[model samples]
Target: MAFGSDRRDPYRAVRLKLFVIQVGALLAIWLVLLSIVYVLMSSELYRVLDSELRRSAIQVIQSYDHNHLSTQNANNQSDFGAAYSLWKITGAASSMSATYIDGTPFIDVRTVYHNALMHPSGYSTTLQINGQPYRIFDALVNLRHGTYLIQVDRSVGPTQVTLSSLISTLIIAGMAALILTLVGGLILTARSMKPLLASWRQQQQFIADASHELRTPFAIIRSNLDVLLHHPDHTIESEMTYLGNAYEEVERTSALLENLLTLARADSNEQILNLSPVSLGELARDVVESTRPLAEWQQKTITLNAPENHCMVIGDPARLRQLLLILIDNALRYSDAGACVAITISCDTTSCELRVQDNGAGIPQNLLPRIFDRFVRADPSRHRAEQGSGLGLAIAKWIIEAHKGQVFVQSKEGRGTTFTVIFPS
Candidate 1:
């Protein structure tokens, strides 16, 4: 019963594995989203920067052509945060000159201008000059004066700073999101596993109880056989008792196996029943009559009280008979001589009710809650005379539930017990 100490925690392992998978999936998705966002943001930023550089290059060319290459006008044209240069190219006459916003030549202008002149069509490139980053755009313009290569260079320090900040923010946010995802995944895993853990524990307990029940009868049968084999010279009449004992254990084992199979089928939802309208009054009378002889032999009384009207419900007749027999047998087994067991049937407009009440030493309050569980018996010692496979009430409950009905029991330690079953009309 102490599931924690008896076995390993399989549910915990499964939950941890599931949580890891979930967190891993979430992290993957987050990384992909961040990659896409960073790519789009960086691309847009570079696009805007390149556009400004191209505009500045065009302005410089226009100012030079209009001012007839005047240095003053060129200095005024360098208003944006960009450096520009002009290269004149004629047959066997190539010369380059550059200017900056501060009236001083920008560092590495000659190398950049030559690189731009080599690729006449417009292109963008990045350069590191004096340990500062610059984004350069090159354009070739064919003016009336000559073919001019205009190179525009802009400082990328601000853009780099902004991008770095964005990267840092994204990293911080991603870390936070990952932490939250891990926590949520763990919580969800635990929540989802609660029922599964309970079911697993129940299954473990069921298997343990079944094995224990089976081992008893097998041990008895084996012992009886061993005794008989040891007494080989004894006459058949003398060893009849040993053979009979073995046979009884065999019968008990067989019954236990049959009940286990029935429960297994029921649990699997594979036991198809032939549902039909059955009269509760007639069924109760039949059950009482069938069990009357046994009750009388024990000096106990069996009675059936039913309304005059037919109490009909949809169910399998044979299974219902078996259900009733199980309850009656349980009642008789637990009751003493002169105790009364009654089967009462009544109906309302929407449902039919059957109550099996026994004037017996009732079930303990602690066991009452799980009385219908498989292999649960009122008598823990399971005295031989009243011993059963302990599946009768479980089967009875399953049959009632299969018919979309409800079964409940009321019992006290010293008083009697009552089992009530209700089925839709």
Candidate 2:
């Protein structure tokens, strides 16, 4: 059982969901990013190519002199950035220059004539060179001597290869990042839920054990009290005195069981709540009035503070009233004689708040967290003869939580304690 309990397996369904979502989002972002990169890089490449082509065309035209004297001097200039083939005409005669690399001319004689028709403006086209493609830009210029045509070509091979490689890299990196994120998130979620799962199991065990413990003691006490009463010599006063203690313990056990049942019912997700709009002012007034007699018996003063007009909240009225009674009862049990306990109802346009503040020996700091835990008491060693079944605060918390409201406590040792409940609009 221990080995089986400790075995760990991946939560595959949740992990798969996370992986798909993360990867899908990353894939979309990468696609957009790669598209933008492609567009911007392509534009910048074209701009640089345009400038280079214009410069090369100007350099080629300057190679000839005003006398129309062609010089071999242009050959030694090393002006052509890349090997290119060129053809030129002087009157009815023609001359040509070819690179030793034996590459086909990117701009042909026919393209130059087309540029001449267009005049000044350039024309661009692609041509094959040594089985590789190059982009060519040709311009026609009417030089002082004669008509001259200049052309430039740039290799597209390296730029295309680089862009394709980068896109592939980005896609691979995005997918890897997505996988790692899903794995990490799944592990974190499981770790976070571990403590809560342990607590739930402990609560289940506690309920089972507490039920058996309570039943035995109660049954024993009741049987003993009954035997004592069956004797003929037993007096009414003695029976009442002795039997009262046993009867009170039984009531305590009953209250504990009742609280557990209420919590069980409340935990059922299918439990239908009797919901209605309740007046906060009226509820506070009624709870205060009902507990007035108990306050007098305990020699404590009870004060109510609420607006004259109705302040409404949406919830189960019976549950709200029960929660109020629990808070007042808890305050009365701990409050010092003659100390004042105030119940205040404050409201705004959107929500309402109820505060019960008591001038009492405030709860110990360490016990504050478990104040709403079943069967947990601040002073466990103290006699339960008159103290409650230790379920009032627990019930109050469950009831408030059921209404989608929050309950909180503020306490300072030996100063006072305040319990606040809030209901949304």
Q: Pick the candidate with the highest lDDT.
A: 1
What TM-score does each of the candidates earn? 0.72, 0.55
lDDT of 2 at 178: 59
lDDT of 2 by residue, 249-275 (tens): 777777778777787776655456789
For each candidate, C-alpha RMSD in Å? 5.6, 9.3
For residue 210, what is the lDDT in candidate 2? 74
Lowest lDDT 10-residue stretch of candidate 2 = 1-10
TM accuracy, model 1: 0.72
Candidates' lDDT values, in order? Answer: 0.82, 0.71
Predicted candidate 2, C-alpha RMSD: 9.3
Q: TM-score for candidate 2, please give it.
A: 0.55
